[model samples]
Target: MEKHILYTTEAVNQDGLNGQSFIKTGGLTVTVSNPLNNKPGTNPEQLLGLSLSTCMNATLQAIEREHGLAHTAEVRVTVTLIKEENFAFLVVARVRIPGVPLKTATKLVALAKKRCPVSKLLSGSSYYQVQVVEDY
Candidate 1:
């Protein structure tokens, strides 16, 4: 598989406060709220919150399927941002898995941390390239 796969989505309603965006897949709807920051776009903090929740949820599902156990997994993500000297965000995730063995839960958490796409991306270093285009 290509490391840099291309994923595309469309956004309309540019006049809204956050450019209301939503994607429809199958029978589900996913919406993103524009963060009220200076950038006036989807904030990284919100995306981080989503990513962490997704990873932890997948791990719980894997454990349930493998062990034939039933439980609800509630993930709480707290994000802190520092924008004074430099821009930074800290995401702390607390996963609640009831009726699961401590060791098994730990294993699942570790595996999820390793396998989650967002976790992997955040763990590695990233930089953005910017370019300015002019109309011909």
Candidate 2:
């Protein structure tokens, strides 16, 4: 078995009607709460979507830099959580790689999907989901 690296995050929440938690990690803080609570904060679902898209984008950016390529990609990830019997979530990763060939862009996104750690954890292959899109 391979050794596992641990990551830590802390959230502080107070007991109240308008209670929300702030997760602190890596010198940054993310405030989260349920939408039903009506408090002003980012929800967990939104954060999850953001994390996945950001990870994929970062991975692709790394690949671009490695190849000394010009231009960059802008990524937007929308995650939908379906309330079903089991864990059901769908992620739509829309990416726009301007000035790059369609074939190259598609290939980079494919590699990102395969290598992104968050995408690995939340596999989209087992369900009816479109993981990546190449937006012109």
Q: Which candidate leads the pack in lDDT?
A: 2
lDDT of 1 by residue, 13-131 (tens): 44454444444333323343545456545554776687677766776677667777775656667676757688776666666666666666666666666666666766664331111
Error of 1 at 1 (Å): 6.2
TM values, all candidates: 0.59, 0.72
Q: List the residue pairs that clash in candidate 2.
A: none
> Whole-model lDDT for model 2 versus the true structure?
0.70
Predicted structure with the largest TM-score when compared to the true one = 2
Which parts of model 2 are misplaced by more than 4 Å? 1-18, 24-29, 36-38, 124-136
Which stretches in model 1 have alpha-carbon errors above 4 Å?
A: 1-43, 125-136
Write down the TM-score for model 1.
Answer: 0.59
**Model 2 agreement with the true structure over 91-122: per-residue lDDT tens digits:** 67777777787888887778877788887876
lDDT of all predictions: 0.58, 0.70
